[model samples]
Target: MKQIFTLGTLAAACIIACAPAVADTATQPTASAGATSAASTSESRKLNKLADEYWDALARFDPVSAGESGDNRYADQIGMSIAPKNRAHQFALYRDYLKRLHTIRRDGLAQRDQTSYDILDYELTTALRFEPFPEHLLPLNQMDALPVTLANYSSGQQAQPLATVKDYRAYLNRLTQLGPWIDQAIANMREGMKTGVVQPKAVMVAALPQFKQLVAAKAEDSIYYTPVKNFPSGFSDADKKKLAAAYRSTIAGRLNPALKRLADFVEHDYLPACRTSTGWSALPHGMDWYLARVASQTTTDLQPEQIHQIGLKEVARIQGEYARIGPKMGYNGPASGLPTWVSEQAKYKPFKTEGEIIDVYRKLNAQLQTKLPALFSLRPKTPLDLRLEPELSRATASDHYTPPAADGSRPGVFWSVVNDPTEYGSTGMVTLFLHEGQPGHHFHIALMQELGLPDFRKFGGNNAFTEGWALYAETLGTEMGLYDKPEDWFGHLNDEMLRAVRLVVDTGMHAKGWTREQSIQYMRETLGYTEAAARNATERYMAWPAQALGYKIGALKIQELRARAEKELGPKFSLPKFHEIVLGEGTLPLALLEKKVDRWIAESK
Candidate 1:
């Protein structure tokens, strides 16, 4: 899942009390040296205090985010985030934070605090810059939406805790608010219809099934009743009975009806009104919107045309790799036909049950764990759990990771979406495990939480750093000797090709006005995705602009930085140390990451 950055609850008082304050004399030039030092120290203290306050306020504003981060203090609340008044209040909060941040002297902050200052300034500025756009009008999409997210939570195995009686009641309270949230979503879409900011017709058509499936005939059959079926061991029969009754009531009385209403409304009202054109460029001020998304998602200044060209070059380069390796795999065919040829190989589709598919990932994890110490000196303390993606969400979901609870009550989970084990291929398992499980998200995210970074840095992430690091992790498979087999190597390259194709296809659609069919065909030919797979991937880009671009763009940047480090440091460069430098500061924007690496090289020299 993409990282959600709503407000979270941290102990503001404790954070402010324990935070260190130090001075830099650069900004207070007119004062005497001692006076400058004191002034700088005071300003630094104030900035730290403000950072804590901001985190606390965010938790109150978006309790679901807070709960996801393991702050159960707000577990009972689910705020109306998309409502106009709430959105105005949220934007006003951003403005206030920005105005206050401008009062601080960045030059006067100590080096560590300066990084915090810059990050906060960038975040607040970005939020306010997007204020003019009515993102609330289009609340949900096929790729991601509140309903899908909440459904995942209702399973009791996701971010929402269901370990105790209080946990159960907290979820019940959260469900009570979903009805109003749905009502507000309908209202927002109505507003969007008037403003010409609605979702495209194709996007809505793909999203319809998600809502429709939630409308079960009885509350007992609803996904929200999942928790009741699997009560914790210690719960008394009386408590279980009461909780189950409460769940059935809430699901029947509040949740199911809201879902049915949403499904009906989308099928009847919203689908017809949705735009026929697939590109974001078709909407009002859409080119600007797409540009902003490109900048924000990649955290780079590269224009869409530049990115598009880079993608085209990358596609050609990866195809060359395929040609060189194809003959080794007993396929003397052209590079374009390699993936299709591999797909037809019976040996690759060996799994017959979900258990067998998961066991491959387990075995991969165990094999990779022994090899990790050679490359990474720093690793996360958090344990990772492997599981199948819940049946309700598997259709639309992809393989992904969810972070462990901040309190350590829950372990990080890698969910593999296996809709059909018979059709599931085994070639991607090794690289997939590397990217979504160990040493990738599990290591990067869990280690960040363990490092005791500031609340904002701990819970927040940008796609470039997070997704880029995962893609980079996939390349490590070659070094670890996991891709020794011809078929395994093909799998790794095929996955890489998908990311490369994303660059070409995402930009082609959003910036160059490529049609949905064009995007689907490009993916099918380049990556050997089946027609269904290709269509699903195409609609994903349509629903989420600039998101797919992050994997390749981010991975390339990290690779570039690694290459520079190797050349500059020579024998002195340590692979583990280089990784430490990259992953040490949590999820930084690409520019900040580059600066950090450059500084490390200079210091080591």
Candidate 2:
């Protein structure tokens, strides 16, 4: 959930999938170099140590990662913000580390270490881009930020443990940083304004409540009170009393007032004054900047127009598949217009209770696992579970993936509907399950973490590779035999169409200057979605302009690569090997992926 605030992209750092140990460094070339020259060996060890230090620094800033990895160096560190100055210092440290990493020759590392080094190098380079943009000027977006996350943290059943007074104190430290962070955010937004880079009015309006909620009403009622309310029985009375007072005072005096300032600035000052244009192209030299983003995210030099066209072709192909399912669902015409039929499917209606919806996904997961090995070879070790979005966030949240902690203590979680299940069409479940669950995110992400990749590769990722692989997994449903049900097969196609629509609409909004309503109308008319579904989906596109474009764009490149690999390898082609090659690389841009796949094909031949 990387948020596009007025300043920085709030790249919500999801927990990287966890592992059993320090990833068997005994096998790392730097750790065991019997054959390398002494100079190479010495340089190799130094580079490896720098790599470890990079992970340590990241985990320290990212409290969730530290807690998940079972690292106690930051155990008492909670609810803290990496100050703007500190963040700049962090960037400088990483730059210095990258220089050290480059000093070591790649030939000195093991095969595994080589891959780790390549991925780390990419992360360091990409991270350097953020330094140019002072994003801390505006940190918390209503859509995704600390306030929203803290509410989630307060729910007893999440990433951080809140059983002890120490945990409460950790949060207090983090929470206290908010006041200063918001001030910094304002400064950053002003900077953006100076450069004509402020967030779209739509984005700011959507985020207003986040500020209001964080600072709303009484201190006792704020979400920053779970530790005060749920302290462990063994806690001393003095610690408990003192922690409760911190929570109360922070919320009443500090948190609420900060929220008021932010909300008023957004709702009253920002939104009304927002730029009407949507695309990054609307900004000064935005076209070149967006092109860079496309290249960086997709890992390819493919032009935006080429991506736009691929989306068109895929949407049509999927639409044909949808037509076949329409009649079966009681529609009169070819199933091709299945979005309409899907909307009419009464059984697929929204749910009255959240528990019932979550339970059904859980059931589907169990049933699928029983059947998955028949078609797929990998699975996530993090126990997949269902959880509800916090009440405050439900209204804005979308179903999301929360990766397992570094210690494998928590399983990869597939968050379901933001609120009620009934809002989305029933036919979408198969496609949704395919993209987010089995053989999709769970397989690509979880399995990579298990393969002993460096921390950078495990925790940091590119959207195109990750999302593209999930969409590619959707087309594999027939191979798994689960799509034998016509409705389910149609469901998969509908999902594909949904992604295709994203490319057209996302490009239309940002690049083509299509209005928000126009995008909504286009999706509704073409995708067979209702007003609510259409609006929700479109707003998502508006909220994140280029991200939705990743799924179809990435998926097409992957499918194209597979066909080429199969054609080249011929009788040597192996699905498991193809999958292994794809997942084994962690996350690379689509173009980089093709290069890797081509190399794999050559090696297999």
Candidate 3:
């Protein structure tokens, strides 16, 4: 699943954190002896204001990000997220902020204020490192393409508002901006081809169907036409007629043509020239580029070889766990063979309808609610909605969580793809819900929004922390009394195995020069992934480097911290309070998180 930005394209990818427009209900922490003076208080306020200004400028520059942030001020605006000019502008913005941030003396700031400084500093520098790579050229993919994002937002199910005539007009404005953006994207890809920076042929091939699906012969059949069809209650008949006609004109005359052109270019022009090689190291300055991505995603100085070795160890451990569980589940198959056996079991694939699949998840959610308070002292106030992945996005989508609207207009949603009901298994339901719903992303993200943290703290996030926290949350499924059955417990290991396998295959393909076929084979043999599943996973790592590394790296760090906390605090250790501390300040880099928890440990002692 794609992280934070709903518009999962290149332009929106670099935005690691942003704040939702939530009321400031969270009180500031008390100042320590080092930070209690009036001067320190004034300095903290100055930093807060500076951070606000910084994020406000950022939200205005990228309308897609603003839309994701629940800031409707730029709702009518849509710009090319990865256009060269825009990239240059964003780079300059980061540089300017970094220079200004340097001018603010960091000494004697409150603990939380210091955290904001460090996170902002790290994010700014990390963003700058991305400037050297040709990310704009490889803008769209099957998992995070513009077509899927547009279809999702326009379906009246995402962050874009469609509640009033003004909201409808704003959406129309965004549609108008698509033609130029699409042209720019095509141009960037063409330039990339000349520079040996083209996307993998498989990715481009997979994206063709999505583009075709997005365009329709009739404007009324387009996903963009949905808002017009389902107009709000207050519009007068005249206004409805006028807006409906305008939407039809925009979708047919402007939007559909753009989609068709892009699809034709990808199928006829781009695909023929697309690179057959899967590794980023195949491109010019590819090794450096891959390393940059590794550092950015993991937010660490880890080498690929190091990460690969870690993955190897993790894979072996999870395999041992899987082996033990297989026999307990009445399967005599080897541990390496358990996933295939369970995937094919009739008892696991019991659902007959899509509604049944969704209902089963809802029941899982209900069961977890009664158990959440025991593990979490603080929970997100935002309501959680369980949904089926939208029809247009399901083919490319996985079961994932989408954050609540910053304005709380819509609740956070955990969507599972139900492409074929009978084939959808229930073995992973509890852990999936735990990871995507409460005590996972929903808890970490929504609580940040609800707490009224700075916009950067509220919206800005690193993958290691965000995804790691979710992976760690999956381990708590048993604590919640959800994974009692051996098959159910095995599903948790299967998922963990997937993350560990990612470490190996992602590093193998990118740094070790392993071919796509080799990576796929490794995944199937070691993780029990079917050939099709293995190929998809391999392609995903190929598309986004080092991203898969974050789950294991982050989860390991969190688990390590929790273990340390439990050991040091001894009888004083409180699971709920430790959870509160971990999530209390929102998403942080692994190092910052360690420091925060260490301070808490010291204070507890």
Off by over 4 Å in 1: 1-41, 69-72
Residue-level lDDT tens digits of model 3 in 165-225: 8888988988988878889889988898788889889877777888888878899989888
Residue 181 Cα positional deviation in candidate 3, in Å, after optimal superposition: 0.2
lDDT of 3 at 443: 91
lDDT of each: 0.81, 0.65, 0.79
Please state every model's RMSD to the true fold in angstroms: 4.4, 5.2, 4.0
Residue 49, candidate 2: how far off, in angstroms? Answer: 2.4
lDDT score of residue 302 within candidate 3: 84
> Cα lDDT for residue 272, model 2?
67
lDDT for model 1 comes to: 0.81
TM-score of each prediction: 0.93, 0.86, 0.93
Regions more than 4 Å wrong, model 3: 5-36
Top model number, lDDT: 1
The TM-score of candidate 1 is 0.93
- Candidate 1 residue-wise lDDT at 215: 86
